[model samples]
Target chain A: MIMKQFRFEPLAQASYLIGCPRAKEAVIIDPIDDLGAETYVLEAADLGLTITGVFETHVHADYISCARELAEMNDVPHYLHESATDLVQYSFTPFKDGQVFEVGGVRIKTLHTPGHTPEHTSFLVTDTARTDEPWCVLTGDALFVGDVGRPDLLLGDQALDVMDEATRAETLYRSVKDRLFALPDHVEVYPCHYGGSTCGGVNMSGKAASTIAFEKRFNLAMRKDTPEAFAAFVKETAKPFPDDYARIKSYNLGLISKDAITEAAV
Target chain B: MKPTEVQDAVAKGAVVLDMRPPKPFAKEHVPGAVNFQFNRADLAERAEMSLPQDLTYIVHAEPDPIAKVAIGILSKAGFSVDGYLEGGLKQWKADGLPTEALPLLTVDELKDGLDRYHVVDTRESFEFRFGHVPGSTCLEWTEPWDQMEGLESEKPLALVCGDQVRSAYVASVMQRAKMDAALVFGGMVDWLERGYPVEKSPKKAKAPRI
Candidate 1:
């Protein structure tokens, strides 16, 4: 089994590849655009693995997602939460909460974790050969090592008023406490963002991974103890949204397409 | 790339991007130079979106590697980069050309001059609140476009920011608008870096989402 994390430091974004060498299969989580799927495909082949699927935790608002492009190139399923929309001209394997995907002896379970965006999901990985107990959870935007995802950005231009800020903040509160932290405190935590990311202010630690126990004890949002407190904390600590956030979100949802990438190639 | 060639390019209105931190840029920059300031949050996206593709741009950034990065990004985003400025603004100064800057005055110089000139800080509220040159007013960077009516008529004005580089950017607007504003070199950063006194205020200026 292999879990590799790649960081785009320019934007402070984190992406991952989890693979099973025995099964020669892999999955990518929360991939950003500009980083071509070919790069990952070639890397996987060198490691004796093939990309089996690509999953997104949510429709991101910061940068375009290359999930669709990557999945197309790999001839693998591109998965998103069932509630996510704007599929454009492509198809996806829409998933529901608690759905399980298996590759060899590793079981990947999806947990619908909404807050940053309504369709956000987290994936919990269990090595069934070792134990039914899970080993790690990829908490996308739902949780970071020292901070929870900021929720207010879901409204306004990005979603075109799909939902209000306060409402999503409350959802983020529930998503963190109920869905993500529900796993045992010792579960290894991996997120799609870390320090220097504009997602939050001050509290986000640059550490690669954290135990649920460590986050529970020290993560500012987790320590808030109530939904109201969590909501307030999130609102208070939200950094200015990332640059080109609305446009990037639109591109990710296919409201806009990568004419820029094509233009660059030309 | 020679000083005279740069002057000729400037005469032809070649876009000059001074990619230094705002304070250093403020401390010294070419008159009419555009300070992209490289450190401004979301700089890459903003430059990609706003820079004109048809016009040729010359870049001058510290740490030569960053200048290369700027040229790469600008050219990739369809900007027609003329070339990197040879030796940056330092060469311009050594060549005895007029490098525009707000008079780098001590506190006493600012006190004597603040009332004689329009003084403004170009940083957002959060940064301004941390500390600023005393007696300077907070003006959002886009105030020229949004709040021009409230601004005083173009006069001998002084522009300040956390770094001198930002003031140079604002100075570009003043140059285009025919407003007489000068860059306050060694802005708040230099003020603090030099252990000069700054007025403290208990407020948090949230950075605006650009």
Candidate 2:
């Protein structure tokens, strides 16, 4: 199995393609816009592989996701957390937490890691050819290289009350230490976002991957600070709410037709 | 000399010294005016380097009060400061001097025009990525100005970002360098809001990569 990560620098977002060369099967995670899908499909075709599944970690607010569009185009099943059905309008096979799915020899175990949003999930993928411990954990917006997703984006009816700086900070704290840190230290941590991402306040280095142990030691957002201090710190550093967030969210919920993708070389 | 005499000297190619911060100068000003930040301690050093003592000097500020103080400084520097721009830049702009737009570009514009123009993105890289005009080389505002010295001495340049202030500063810098440049009015937000085309980064480009 070969895994490649695509970093979308503008949005500070990352997507993944886990391919099993022997079986010619693959899966994509958290597709951001159409670029990820186009790149992954071209690369997979170049390597003689086929995409069987598309997984969306959650409805992202920062950028529009083309996961449903990509899945439909490729004739692949789209996977989402069962709880996400209410939040997302697209059709998908709802996988409950702890459910395991197989793509060739790779076994993926889904873990509910909701704080970034109520339906967020992380996938731990184990290669049968390798050890029982997963090779890498695909943590979407739920965890970043040096920070956790800010929970304030999903505050709908209680948008004002739940988004009080302190409440979101405490929620982020619980999501990281309680859910993500419990994984084995040796497991490679592949986060969905890096620095420059407005989704999380403190993304770390530009490098796409880090070890759970490495982040546990060097990630400032992971340090043992009091909840009060953490709240204050995040409040001070938090980005102003993105101007296009509501539009992006509505797009993610299938409330609007996907905009035509423009083709211009970067 | 009187203000009318100063205006007459300016018509004959005398220098109009705009002692305002870069921000106000970029918005609108006397067409050929030069700016020197009044608050900087190295004001003398910068003025000496950029300003030619041979030309008659006319001091100006956004409001008139600062112009009076600038005239005093120029006199102390041995400049035969003639007079000031009465009512300063505001008056000049109000009188219908040319004003430029500052805009962030769509990715498509960046791709099509990147080679033809000097592409300067003033926004931070993170902001650049959420979708920037393609082909734009990011020159972060915090980065040292000398790094951009390699750009040709003469080219039509465009400065882009999420807003006007930063790009306007960039345009002023290029203008000071005597380069042909303009601010992409309204910045990137304006471009997108108007439904202009923007290319996604190549790695993230799901659409056919042009």
Candidate 3:
């Protein structure tokens, strides 16, 4: 499998271009809207790959996603969790939990890891030629290097079926403990944001990647032994919500037109 | 042909024509198998240019159709062909046949054994201008496999890019061309994050010392 990470310094956001070079095909995950669709298209071409799909881990609140634009531009499917189909305005291919797809020698399995937001997903990638075990996981916003995504973003929001902060925090804990922590110790963890990003709780690492073992050993969120404890940690560390999140989320959900997203809004 | 039959045919001096992409072929394949990727447009031409027509060959490819396509192309190229392996390498492995793998080096392993490798930085010159492995040769990942320079050495080539993705692809193709190349998983990002020594000035790919 071929994978490249593109980092947006200002927002501390990261997007990935993962491909199977032999198959000459690739996919973009969590593309930033301001990055422009052509950036990925040209980048993939330079690597001798064609963009075949686009995926969003969740309806992001911090920034808009270019998943729709990239998918439409490439004439490929835009994938989101089945639970998000009704919540968003645009059309997409709704994938269920544990759904697996192949791009040549690379196999990507979707794990429904909802916590930060209800429809969040993570991609577990395997290079079948090398090993049946997953080589790395794209943890979207669920699990970061030293911190996990904050679950309080949707608290009191107008988005569909909003949950309270405590309940969402508990769900995130379970998702991390049961779904993410279950992976092998050596599996590399690549999250969407890192240090200086508003998405994760305080203590997020400046490092871009970490092994599951390292994260398990040092991550503050993972140290919490119980869901209640984890919820309390989240509440204790919650920072003031960014004022532009609602506008960003609305644009991402396609609730508003592209024109509605002014330069000042982002 | 069934997996067991492929083994029998192999014993009778039939060559296994692996029709998968270079990466899978590099990672694992039948012992003594020759890879001619099914996706290559010049599969028949490349095979005809290199392979002996008198020898019988068996196709090993996945999804069944890929194997069939290779077989058809070989037959048209006037090569004597045996039937394809029933379930490709997956079935071959299931039947307990032996396979081989190329090296996939982690950043730490590459650092520890730097002397044993001809470190090839596959990142672009612009990216390489910032920082790269000390004494590494800069050969952009997009450089055609045959056109790549500074790789002919007693030491195995260790391929690196900003991340492992580009180097992995280059290493796959390099292995397919029968070069002694190992992919540096996580590449320069991992190397830099680990605080390894780096050369800020870019170096051009030069012919290897005799």
Which is the leading candidate under lDDT?
Answer: 3
Score each candidate by Cα lDDT. Answer: 0.72, 0.67, 0.80
lDDT of 2 by residue, B1-210 (tens): 344555578778776666654444555566556544453244455456445577677876533545666677677777778788775545555565554422334345654566666666777767776776655666665443344333453446777867554565556555655667666655686667757656555433111111
Tell me the lDDT of model 1 at A81. 90
Better of 1 and 3 by TM-score: 3
Candidate achieving higher DockQ, 2 or 3: 3
TM-score rank order: 3, 1, 2
Cα error, residue A6 of model 3, in Å, equals 0.6
For model 1, what is the alpha-carbon lDDT of residue B139?
A: 71
Candidate 3, residues A146-223, lDDT tens digits: the string is: 999998887355556466777778888888888999999999999999998889878898898998889889999779
Positional deviation of A219 in candidate 1, in angstroms? 0.8
Question: For model 1, what is the error of residue B147's alpha carbon versus the real structure, in angstroms, after optimal superposition?
Answer: 85
Between the candidate structures 2 and 3, which one is better when assessed by lDDT? 3
- How many residue pairs clash in model 1? 13
lDDT of 2 by residue, A76-155 (tens): 78889898776666678899999998887888899888767777899998988677777888988776777667767753
The segments of candidate 1 whose C-alpha lies over 4 angstroms from its true place after superposition are A86-90, A155-161, A260-266, B1-210
Q: What is the lDDT of residue B44 in candidate 1?
A: 61
- Where is the poorest 10-residue window by lDDT in model 2 chain A? A257-266
